[model samples]
Structure formats: structure tokens, C-alpha cells
Target chain A: MTTPLVSIDNLTVAFPIGRKLFGPPPMVKAVKNVSLSIPKGSFVGLVGESGSGKTTLGRAILQAAPITDGKITYDDGERRYDIASLSKDKLRDFRSQAQLIFQDPYAALSPRMTVRDIIAEPLEVMGLTKTREETDARVREIAAKCRINLEHLRRYPHAFSGGQRQRISIARTLAAGPKFVVADECVAALDVSIQADILNLLKQLQRDLDLTYLFISHDLSVVAHVCDYVAVMYLGEIVEEGPTREIFANPQHDYTKALLAAIPSLDPDQRSRVVSFERGTVTVDG
Target chain B: MSLLSVENLSIRFKTDEGLITTVENVSFDIQEGEVLGLVGESGSGKSVTAKAIMQLNGRNTVYDPASKITLHGGPDIDILSLKRERDMLPIRGGQISMIFQEPMASFAPAITVGKQMVEQLQIHTTMSKAQAKELSIEMLDRVGITEPARRFDQYVFEFSGGMRQRAMIAMALTTKPRLLIADEPTTALDVTIQRQVIDLMKELIGDFGMSILFITHDLGVIAQTADRVAVMYLGRIMEQGAVRDVLRTPAHAYTRGLLNALPNLDNLDAPLTPIPGDIPSPLERPSGCVFHTRNPELAPGSRYETEIPPMSEIRPGHFAALFPEDVQ
Candidate 1:
């Protein structure tokens, strides 16, 4: 088989809690011995409830979180880098190849910057373009692809609605021409109608730009709709991973089954069909 | 007669830009012991309608003179006529109680959970301090918070996210209000926790025999809890009907768009069709049908562009705001 765009082997991320100088500090294992591969140009969804370590696993792959143990490698089919021990220069170069789309669009973009500058900031910071004109051209191309109106490029974030602001955020993430993206709950803050629009945009961009996405979200229905492959995380470990259709049709894990059953059905007459499962919170292990 | 009836309700706010009409000519009734779901996206004024029921809108809010909100039982109080805070006391928490999306915000960080609940019971009823304490613990236990006596003495910060929400619900129900306004109570919770909360609420409603005004953007939650549903957009109700009729066979274009937009588990391969355009800002309110901007079925230069369609009864007790030909 061809080399995957991203590969992980027993990846683990841990955070120290209440450290002391005497002995080893207690460590909370945010991500535990997780292994998965994301193929090129594939939309892979990672879903779980809160405290399930889905976000940490996504960040670990992006080299944004502490890799306490295990291996994570990024291969663009051209160059492969060991994310845990990358040099400063290599890490800087890797930043342009992998990006993140934050959950809260309101907090992600700077309120002071106009839409043009916000999207262009990445190009400038990465020094991807030599001239200002080149940066403007790239920003315009991505903004247009994100379905943002050209006339609204001069307006601040406050002027746009939640849906429009999210589009702006997407344009900014794509400005540097990343091959892999981690969209962390990107549409959670938007309304359902707006969520569909954003999801459609992501799918279209994946095809147009040949991009791979590690979509991390708590909503299962969204994962089932957009993802080609699905991974279910529970308490810092991957309990199940398979094709989206197969996972949704026949879930194996108890946690995955409970989550699927918890989605309130739109059929009012099917109220009695709601499966009653034992409810318990998953606390992070230390 | 319904338990609570709101007729010709219009609310305008004095914003920095100009006079913004947030909720316009909206009308609905909640029968006793029935659940009414108010579904809308952001800026749809669903929360404003709930706040108006409690008279909790800010000082700059101006209610239309024709607006009437009458609570049917117990002397048939005219909610809109209440001017003083003292006059609203009996209705605010006595006959009407509200639970918010963020339980942390509703709860006082400094006060113990039990003390606050007991205080509400004392003010609303003639219960003594000792009696209120016992009832507070009982309510907490009823809502499924384990070790209620221990949890009562602790602050909200000490409780988990789910536990805090349960405490908030317990406190709200202690007054035995005839009507409860649950504003996105489960939005902050995980799916499993949300299911538990929904089940607890269903049990409470059955036991207390109180009406609930369930406000949320999630149609699924509405389907599970609400008997009647009202779809809102840009300060207007696009459709109002029985939940089954609205969800299964939505009549209005906006309502149909919302249902179609949701990613259905049953039809995983179907493409999601989002409503065409962004919900227009209040300052740029459309001249006619408020949803004309986002409605895909509306043709250009149609009467919908110039005239607001009245709510027409498409079926018995199912209403859609549409022109005769616009009905699907």
C-alpha cells in the first residue's frame, strides 16, 4: 500500500499535575497508546464525548501537544518528518503543511483585523509569498473558494454572522496551502443550517485542493455524514475505528452504541424507541 | 383556554444602530402540562420571547401596545401590565421558573447550592427554613444528584458540569411553578449526559404536571420533548404545529430547509441541503416575509417579497405562514 499522509504508532500524550521536585509528578494520560493512519485526501472523523482525549490526539498529530511517549510521523508523499523530534527549522516548515481550524470563530480571528488581513496574515507569517500582491492574490483565491463575498473583505469580524465568520476562519487556515488540517469542532458554535454549509464547504475543498482532514467533533451524526473513515475515542484510547458506514450501521463498542442511541430521533412517535443506557462520566486517568 | 396565551406580541430594542425589532407580531399558546418547543437559530428572538414572558428584557425594550400575555390560572394575570419588580415577583419564580443554558452563570459562586434553593422556596412559599432545607435535599435527590445532602453544602464550582445542571434544575423546580422555561438546558452537556437530563425532565413534567417552554436550536430535542413546535426566523414564526406534523411533513419552506439541513443517521448518504442564504441581520430586516432572504422556494418578484404572509391553517392545528400558492 502507498504511504499514508499521516501515521501514528502507539501515540501517547500526558500532562503533569501538581508537580513537585521530590519524586515523579502525577501525570494525566490525555491520549493513551493510540494508533491510526490517515490516508491522503481522506476526511477521517474522530468522535467522542467530552474528556475523551479526541482533541489531544488531534493536537498530538499536529505537534501542538506534549508527546510523552510513542511515535507520530507526517509524510506528504515527498518528505517525512518525525513530529516528536523535529528541528526548529523543520518544524517551522511543517507549520505551513499542517494547520488547525479552531472551534470558536469569534475567538479564533482577531477582532481588529479586516478579513483580507486576517487571511493574509498566515501567508505573511510563513513568508510563503515574496510580494504583497502575491499574498493578496492567494487570499482572494481562498476567500472566493470559501464562498466569502469579495466586497466584504474590508469588513471586520464583528460585521459578519457566525456562518460567515467561520468561512473567514477556513480561508485563513487554507491560505498557507496546508496539505493536512485538523478542524477541531469547527462547526459546533454555528447553527445547524450553517453547519451543513460549512461541512459542504469542507468536503468541496477536500476535493478541489486534495487535502486531508482529521475532523475532531463530539457530534456523531456529523461524523457519519462527512467522514470516509471513523474512529471512536473513549477515555484517551481508541475503542473502535472503521469505515463510517460500517461503524454507523454496526457499532461494536458499548460506548459507541450508547452514543448512537443517545441522539434524539426526529420522529416524535418513536419516543419509546430511545434506548435506555447506563449513563456514566468518563474521567481522565492519571 | 390555554394555560398561558401570548397575542400580537412585538418587541423592539433601542440599539446603537437604530430601533431593532427583535420579535414581531408573534403569537402562541402553551396549554397546561404541555411542552411547547420554540426552535430557531441565532437572532431568531426565541429567547426574547421567553424573557418577555418573565418580563426579564432590558430597560430599552419596548413592547407593542397591542401585545397581551395572560396567564390563565390563578386570577388570570396580565403579564404585560406588570410594571414594578415587586408586582412581577409572584409570577417570576412563584408561578413561572426558568433554567438557563449555562448553569454556572445562573448559580452564585459564593453561595452553597442548598442555601440558594432553600431561599427560593422560602420566598415563593411560606415554608420555614428547616422545611425548605429538607425539601431542597429531596429535590436534589429527585434530580439524580448522588449524595444530595453532601452536595447541598458544596458550591457550584465543586460539582461536575452535569451535576451543576442537575442542581440548577432541582432549584428551579423547588418552587412548584406551573410553567417552566428551559432555555437550552442540555446544550452544554455531552450526548449521554444530555439524554439523562432529558429523561429526568420528562419524569419531572409527569410528576409536577407543569407546562414547559423548551427553547433550543436542536430539532431532535424538540421532537423528543415538545408536543407542539414553532419554527422561528428573523423575529417571526415561520411555522407552528404539532411536532409530528412539523417534523414528518413540514409545510413551510424554511421549516423544510431546517429539517433537510440536519444530517440524518437513517439517510447517511443523502446530501444535506442548507437553507440558501444567511439569516438577515435585524437592521436589514426584509420588507415582507422575514425568511424571504434564505428561502429557496421563493421566486423573485413574488408577492412574498412585498407582503408578509399570514399564518394559514394547512391542516387542523397545523399553521404555516405562507401565501396560498406557496404552500407545499
Candidate 2:
């Protein structure tokens, strides 16, 4: 088998609580010892409820969050770099190979920037393109792949709808030509009808570009449909990890079962059978 | 008897663009101890209709004078006719209680959760501070809050998101209002918490004997909780019927599109067929069916472009707005 693109070994992220004015301050363990691996050209889903630290895990992989312990190494079938201890030059190079698609399209994209500039900003900031023409060409190219209308690129973000804004956000993220993409709740804010469109677009892009995706969302139905492999998170730990179908059909963990049972099935004659599960609140580091 | 009845209710907001219609000729009834699910997309006017019943619209809102929004309490007393705050006061928090989408913002930061509940009970009823506090703690525990007394003294930020939502529900139920308007109460919560909250609401409905107008964008939630479901589109009721019938055999094109778009866990590879076009701005609603602009099955005719379509009964108690040729 080919080598894994990314491997995280016993990772932990802790945040200091209150202030260090008095004695040694306590720390909130946002994410505990967790180990996971992402294969090349695979769609992996990380799901959990609030305080699950799924978002923190995603950010840590992208080097956006503080990695308190353990090692995170990324390899693209070439040179490997320690994400936690990246040099300035290595970090700069890592930018072109890894990208993030933010959850809230409304807040993610700059309101003042036009759609063209928003998509082109990453290229210009990274100095990936030589001239304005090159940046414009690259923006148009990715926008087309994302199925965005070229005419709308001239308009500001305010002029577009939620779905359109998300497409614009996707296009901007992909403009960096990253091998791995972390889409954090990318379709959560969109309407159901529009969510399907975005989901399809993401899959098509993944297939066409040979890109790996870390799709993080709270919605299980969406995850079941799109993800190849699934990892269920609870209180910042992976409670279950398996094939999406296997996990959905028979969830092992109580938290995973509760999440599945909570989803109102679309079928009509289906009586919602409330699965008997403990609703015990897990207060970590309290 | 039905607790509330809305007949030919139309609402328009005076926007900078024009008189943007939000609700058009929408009508529904909520019987006592019944849960009605109002399911629709972003522009579906479900929230507007709920707000209209509570007289929560702003100064820019224009409700048709001929419209009938009757809030039936026992038998008589039309809530719409009561203009004075003194008269409407008894109905606002006394008869109808509302819970919003965001619980964090709805609560005050500085005040303790217990203090807020006590203040609401005092204003609406003749309960003393001591009596109110006791009942409030009971309400919190009933909603599955652990250490209710300790939680009562904590600020809103001190409670987790799920706990805060439970507190909101507990506060809403303190008055034991006859009608509960839960507008996307669980939409912001995680799936696990959402299930707990949905179950709690259903259980509360049984004991409280209160009518609920549950508004949400997810049709799946409607199928599970609501006895009946109404599918709204661009501020109009495209389809209204039993949850099973509506989900099994959706009459309107918009309803069909919505069902097709939802990601089905059972069928992993099914392509989500999104509705063709954007939801037309309320200011420029289509001449006939409001959904006709985005509908793929728009019959080729000048009539559809000019004349308005009337809602026709497709099944027993099921009404859908569609042209004859488009009916499946």
C-alpha cells in the first residue's frame, strides 16, 4: 500500500484557563490523546457535537491551531515536514499544498472584496501568480471548476446568496491548488436544495483533481452520503472510526448511536424509535 | 376547539426595493395539544407566519386589514382585535410563549438564569418570588438539567450551549402558556443535543396540553415530531397536509425538490437534484405560483405568467398550489 498523506500520533491540545496572576493556572484539555491517519485521495469525515474538539483537530492539521503535544507529519509522496515544527520556508511551501474551506461563508469571505479579488487574494498573497492577468486567469479557471458564473465575479460578496457565496469561498480555497482540503461545515449554513449542489461539486473536484478532503460536519446524513471513512468524536476523542456505511449501519459508541438516532429519517411510515441511550453530560476538565 | 386559526393572512414588508411580500394568503389552524410542523427553505415565511400570530412584526410590516388572524381562547376573544397593551398583555407571555433559534442571545448576560425566570413569572402571574423560584427549579430539572439549583444561580455563559437551550425551554414553560411557538429551537444545536431537545419538547406537549407551532428548515425533523406538516415557499404555503402524506407523495414541485435535495443516509450515492433557480426575491414574486420561477415543470402558457394559481385539494386535507397541467 502507498504511504499515508498525513499521520497524527497521540496529539493533544490544551488551553490555559483564567489568568496566571496567582498560582499555576489550570488548563482546559480541548483535545486529548488522539491518533488518526488520512490516506491520499480519500474523503474522510470527522463528526461530533459541540465541545467535541473536531474543529480544533481540523485546525491543528492545518497548523492553524496550537498543537500542545505529539507529532503531525504531512507527506505528499515527496518531501515530508513536521507540521508542528515547520521552518518559515517550509511553512510557506506547505501553504500551496494544504488549504481550508471555512464553514460560515457569510463570515469567511471578505465583504469588501469583489468575488474576483476574493478568489485571487490567496494567489496574490502567496505570490503564486506573476501578474494581475495570471491571477485573473487562475481565478476564472478555479471558478469554472467550482461551477461559478464568470459574470458574478465582478460583484461584491453582498450581492450573492448563501449558496453562491459558498461556491465563491470554495473557488478561493481551491485557487491555492492544494492537494489536501479541509472543508469545515462548508455546507451547514446552506439550504438543503443548495447543499446537494455543493456536495456534488466538492466530490467532482476531488475526483478530477486527485485531492484529499477532511470534511468536518455535525450533520450525519450529509456525512454518510459523502464520506468514504468516518471518525466519530466525543469530548475531543475518537470514539469510533470505520467505513461510513459500517459506522452508520451499526454504531458502536453510545454517542455515535445517539447522533444517528436523533436524525429524523426522511421516510414517512417510519416511526421514530427513540434509542435508549444515556444523556449523561460529559464535562471535560471541570 | 382549535386554539388559533389563521384565514387568508397576508403580510408585506415595506422595503427600499418595494412592497416585498413575505406571507401570501397563508392559512392554518393549531388545535389544542397538537404539534404542527412548518417546514420550508430560508425564504419560506414560516418564521413570518409564526411572528404574525404573536403580533411580533415591526412598524414597516403591512398586514391586510381584511385578513383574519384569530386566536381562539376556549371559545371567544379574538386576539387580533385587542389593541391595548393592557389587553394584549394577558396574551403575550400569558397565553403564547415563544422560543427563538439562538438561545444565547435571547438570555441576559449579567442576570442569573433563576432571576430571569422569576421576573417573567411575576409579570405574568401573581406568584411570589419564593413560589416562582421553587417552580423554576422544578422546570429546570424536568428539562433534564442536572444540579438544577446550582445551574439556576449561574449566568448564561456558565451553562453549555445545550444547557442554555434547556434553560430557555424551561423558562418558556414556566408560565404554562397554552401555545408554544418554537421557531427553529434545535437548528443551532448539535445532532445529539437536538435529539434530546426534540424528545423533551414532545414529552412536554403531552403533559402541558399546549399547542406548538414548530418552524424548521429540515423536513426530517418535521416527519418525526409534527402530526401535520406545511411546506412553505417564498412566503406562501405550497403544500399542507399530514406529515406522512406530504413526505410520501409531495404534491408541489418545490416540495418534491426539497425532498430530492436532502442527503439520504439510506441511499449514499443518490445525486442531490437541487431546485433549478434561486428563490426569487419577495419583491419580485412570480405572477402565478411563487415557485414557478424556480420550478422545472413550468407549463408553457401565458396564463401561468399572468394569472395567480389557487390552492387545490390533492388528498383528504392536503392542499397544494399547482397548475392543472403540472399536477402529477
Candidate 3:
């Protein structure tokens, strides 16, 4: 079998809660012992409800989260990186290959920065280009690739609409020449019509740039729409993982079935609400 | 007779830029014990129309003289004619209660949930403090909140997202109002939690015999919950009909565009077709059909560009912004 572009092994992310004076503190295990893999250039989706650690796992792959245990390996057919164990110099090298697209576009970009400056900042921070002309050329190229209006590059982010701002966000992410992108609920904040535009843009960029995506979202229908493979998380564990079609067609886990049954169908006669949510009797949130 | 009737409703807000009309000549009726969904994208003025029923808009809001909103419940009350906030008291909580997209926005973080619920009951109902507290606890339990009595003493920040929403629902329904204006009540919730809330609302509607003016950008939610539907674009109602008619066979171009934009679960292979062009800014209002700019079937600079079509009957109970001959 071909080596996957990114692979994980027994990843566990825990945050210590109550502190102890003499002993260890109690912990909340956000991501339990789990493993996932992304094939090269595949749009892999990570879907789960809030507090399910889907976001934490996405951050862990980029070494943005504190890893209590396990390993994450990133290999792009050129250089290999054991993300959690990389040295400072090696981590700086790996940073250029991995980037995160935030969930809220409104909060992601700096309000005062011009569109050109925002996109160019990443390329400059990574020192990808030496000269001013080279950086300007790269920014314009990415703006066109992301379908942003090249003429409006001098305006601030406040001047653009939500869809236009998202295009700017995409341009900034890809400017650093990343091999893998973690799109964390990138379209959740936009309207459905605008959401389709962004999703289509992401699909096109993936094909054109040869990029692998870890699309993290709570919306499953969207996952089934764009993802090649999907892994469903519940309470810090992977309950199901397979091809998008197979998982949607025959969801084995009760939790996965419950989730799929919850999406309201567009057809009036086919509201098959087969699964019902019963609040956790064991829940102890005081 | 319908429980509430909104006719020729138009609303404008006084802004620094100038007077801008957000809702234009929209009309609909909410029958007793039925859900009427106002479906649209952002800036569609669905929420503004609902707010106008309770006279909840800010002081800068200007309601057109031609606009009329009437409540047909015991003595017919002209909603638009009420001049004072105190006069709106009976209609605000006693006749109509509203829930919003974010429960946090509606809830007071400083107060206990139970205290707020009891206060609402005190203002709206004749029940004493002891009676109100008991009833509030009962409502919390009814909405499926566990340990309702204990949770009632907790502040809004203590409860989880789903629980907070349920708490808000309990507070809204505590008055036993005739109408519930749910403005994207479940949009912030997860799918499973959203399903629970929708089910709860359906169950409550059955138990209380209430009418709902449900506003949302989601067609799927409307398909599941609404008995009747009105499709809004820009500031106008492009189409209105029975839920089955509108969803199965939409007559308007904007309605078709919205349905096409959603990712269909059955056919995963078909590419998503977003409505072309951005939604026009409120400052640059289109002259005729507001949706004509993004409309795919019709051509720009045509007669329809300047001629605003009326909502003519397409079928027995279906109406669209096109004449009978225009229906394809």
C-alpha cells in the first residue's frame, strides 16, 4: 500500500483540570486513544459534535496542541516530520508545509491589514521569497487562484463581504505553499448560497495545487458532499471511519446512525427521524 | 379566521446612510395551530417582519402607513397602531413570545434561570411567587432538562449550549402565548440537539395549540416543521404556498435557486450550484424584481427588469411573483 501523506498512532490529548498541591491533577481526555490516516491529496473529513475533540485533533496534527501521548507523522514525498518530536529548526521547516484555515473568517484576518499585506505576511514570515517583487508576484498569483478580485487587493478586510473575506483567508493560507491544510468549519459562518461558493473553491484549489485537506466540521451532509473519506468522532473516540459512501449508506455505530438520522430531509414526505436523542443519564455537569 | 394577519407590511430604518427599506410589502397569515415558515437567506427581512408583530423594532424603525398587522384572537387588536411600549405589554408576552438564534443573547447571565422564569410569570400571569416558581420548574422538566429544580438555581453560564436553549424555550412557552416567533431558534445547535429542539417545539405546538412564525435560512428545517411556507428574497415574498406545493414544485426562480444550493444527500455526485452573484447591498436596491440580478431563467434589461409583478395565484393555494402565463 502507498504511504499515506499523514498518519497518526494512538493519539491522546488530555488537559489537566483541578490542580493538586502534592500529587497529579485530574485530567479531561479530549482526544482518546485513536488513529487516523490521510491519503495523499485526498479530502479527508473529521466530523463530530462540539466538545468531541475534533478541533483538538486537527490542531494536534499541526503540533498546535499539547500531546499527552502518541505520534503524528507527516510525509509529502519529499521531507518527513514526526510533528510532536521535531526540533525547533525542523519544526520551523515543517511549519511552512502545514497551515490552518480558521472557522470564523471574521476573526481570522487582521482588520487593519490590506488584502495584499494579509496574504503576503505568511509568505514573508516563512521567508519563501527574498525580494519585494517576488512576494508581490506570489500574492497576486494566489489571489487569482483563489478567484479574488485582483483590483481590490489594496482595500482592508472590512470592505469585503463574508464570501470575499473567505477568499482572502484561503489565499493567505495557500500563500505559504502548504502540502496539507486543516479547514476547521471554514464555511460554518456563511449563508448556504455563499457556503457553496467557498466549498467549490476549496475543491478546485485542492485539484490545482495537489493539496490534502483535513476538513473538520459538525455538518455531515457537507462532509458526504466533498469528502473522499470520513472519520466520525464521539466523546473523544472514533466510532466509525470509512469511505464517505459506505459510511453514509451503512452507518454501523449507533451514534453515527443517530447523527445521520437527525439531518432534516428536504423532501416533505421523507422526514425519517429514526433516531431520537435521549439526554445522557450519566451526565454530571454541575 | 387566522390568528394573526400581516398585510402590506413595509419597514425602513433610519441610518447614517439614509432611510433604507429592509422589508417591502410582505403579507402572510398565521392560522391557529399551524406553523408558517418565512424562508430566506441573510438580509431577507424575515426576522424584521416577525419583530414588527410585537412592535419590537428600535425607535429608528419606521413602519409604512400602509402596513397593517391585526391580531384576531378575542378582541381584534391593531398591532401597528399601538403607540406606547407599555401598551405593547399585553401583546408582547401575554399573546406573543419570541425565541432567538442565540439563547445567550436572550438570557441574562447575572440572574439565575429560575429567577428570570418566575419574573416573566409574575409580569405576564396572575400566579403568586410560590406558584410561579413551581410552574417554572415544571416547564424546565417538560423541556427535558434533567434535575430541573437544581438546574433552575444555576446561572445561564453554567448550563451547556443545548440546555441553555431548552431553558430559553421553557421561558418563552411559560406564558402560554398564542403565537411563538422562533427566529432561527435551532441554528446554533448541533444536528442531534437541533432535532431534539424541533421535536420539542412540535410537541409543544400540539399540547398548547399555538401558531408559529418560524424564520430560518434552512429549507430542510422548513420542510420538516412548516405547514405552510413563504419564500423571501431581498425584502419581498417571492412565493407562498402549502409546504408540500412549495417544496415539491416551486414556481419562483429564487425558491428554486435556494433549494438547488443545498447539498442533496441522495445524489452526492451532483455538483452544488450556488445562486449566481452576491446578494445585493441594501443601499443598492433593485428597481423591479429584487431577485432579477441573480435570476437564471430571466434575462436582465427585459420588461421584467422594470415591471414588478404581483403575487398571482399559481395553483389552488400557491402564489408566486409571476403571472399565470409566466408559470412554466
Top candidate, metric TM-score: 1
- What's each prediction's clash count? 0, 0, 0
Can you write out model 1's per-residue Cα lDDT over B70-153, one digit (the tens) per residue?
999769999999999999998998899999999999999999998899888888999999999999999999999999999989
Residue range with the least summed lDDT across 10 consecutive positions in model 1 chain A: A277-286
Better candidate number, 1 or 3, judged by DockQ:
1
DockQ of each: 0.84, 0.71, 0.79
- Model 2 segments more than 4 A misplaced: A22-24, A276-286, B299-303, B324-328
TM-score of each: 0.98, 0.96, 0.97
TM-score of 2: 0.96
Instruction: Report the error of model 2 at residue B145, Å.
Output: 2.3
What do the candidate models score in CA lDDT, each in turn? 0.92, 0.87, 0.91
Candidate 2 lDDT score at position B170? 97
Q: Cα deviation of B148 in candidate 3 (Å)?
A: 2.2
Best by DockQ: 1
Model 3 Cα lDDT, one tens digit per residue, A64-167: 99998998999987899998899998988888999999988899999989999999999898889999999999999999999999998999998877888999
Report residue B49 deviation for candidate 2 (angstroms): 1.3
Cα RMSD to the true fold for all candidates = 1.5, 2.0, 1.9
Worst 10 residues of 2 chain B by lDDT: B297-306
